[model samples]
Target: MKRVPLYAAALGFIVFAGFPFYWMFITAFKQNRDLYVGAFDTRHVPWIFNDPPTLEHVRLLFGQTDFLRWVANTLLVIVAVVIITVALAVPAGYSLARLVGRWGGRLGMGIFFTYLIPPTLLFIPFSRVIALLGLQNSLGALILVYPTITVPFCTWLVMGFVRSVPWDIEEQAMIDGYSRLAVIIRIAPRLILPGILTVVVFTFTLVMQEFVYALTFISSVDRMTVSLGVPIALVRGDVYHWGSLMAAALFTSIPLAILYNLFIDRFIQGFTMGAVKG
Candidate 1:
């Protein structure tokens, strides 16, 4: 009897969460005629599965767009951000948690607060910086700027995670003559594995979705990230390419979803631990 309610709740949650993605997936396969007919006709009974599916959209998208380049650029930016974030955040977080006595918690919060400053306000100054460095429209410019937003928040997250680790482990390792660098390479990785994975997944998704800075900074078709690239490149001005747009969105999201699902338990552990301990 108790399990009945639980099952019902789970079913409801699944429907709520999965509906938009299901809609997007089906919409991508929909013929343009069906899509526009529904859009234009008020009385056209909305039936997603009822319409005949087509691969024309997928073919048109891949054939006509610089989608692969966008995907490649997005991956490049994400990999660079992950490297910079992990390298900077892990060590900085460990130091903040262990070295600072009473101020570590407060400092962590302050660093997180910096991430809240809207990117809208930063883009103008960032654009100037990008131009001055002569990296305008280059992936390197995004690689440079994205870290400013990603690092502070990731550092704060790592600080909370590192704080949760039992100090006795490090202390014993130290007495056994393990250096700080050795602890970081050997012991810390095992201890903070969940936290590290959380940072990877979090930052990867962020770079894929973040747009304001990308839009303002990158105007060249070859240089745009997936978020900007798909919409800008696939559609002519004022004429939306719904099929290709949805197709791009579907393909881009699937990999992340699969990866997240693979490590969901660890991801949840990272969040709960960070929240409760911090």
Candidate 2:
């Protein structure tokens, strides 16, 4: 009998969390007449298929728009940004955690505070930098600009994670004649895998969702990321394509959802261990 409440609570939470995806799925496949007409008809059911589902929106998204290109661009940016974030954040974090001694925590916090500065404040200055570099309207602008937002915070995150790792393993490795650089390259990474995965996931999601810098720097249709491209392509001057918009969202979000599911355990471990220590 006690399990009933627990199951009920679990069910409720699932419904609450899963509702948006459910809504997106239904809306994406819903016919325009069914979707619009049902809104006016109070007796009509909104959640179920009052009319037969259609692939019209999906067709429009793929057939008419540069959605595939946007996906490719998004993937490209994600890969580059994740690589940059991991490469820079891991080393900076390790240095702050191990090499800098007592002041490392303060330094790490200082770096983290830079990440707290709102993107709204940074975009203007970044725009000038992008222009000066002549990267406007290009994927290179996004690649160049995204790291500024990701690196500082990720450095702090990695530093915290590194603190949680016991120094015993690395110390033993060093005593066994493993050079500092070799231990860092070979042994430290294995201990910090969870944190690296966390950074990768964080960077990937950030680049996928970021719109401000994308909008500020990229004006060309062909170069737009999915977040920027979908709305720009679908919403024609306040005339919203709800079905297509939902379709785009559904397509874009599924991969992210899957990624979270896959890395959820390690992701949680990374944050929790980091929080407890550094």
lDDT per residue for candidate 2 within 122-192, as digits (tens), equals: 89998898889999899999998899888987897788778878999999999999999999999999999
Q: What does each candidate score in C-alpha RMSD?
A: 3.0, 2.7
Q: How does candidate 2 fare on TM-score? A: 0.88
Off by over 4 Å in 1: 1-18, 38-43, 259-278
Give all candidates' CA lDDT scores: 0.83, 0.87
Report the Cα lDDT for residue 107, model 1: 84
Scanning candidate 1 in windows of ten residues, the lowest lDDT window is 269-278
Q: Each model's TM-score?
A: 0.86, 0.88
- How many pairs of residues collide in each model? 0, 0
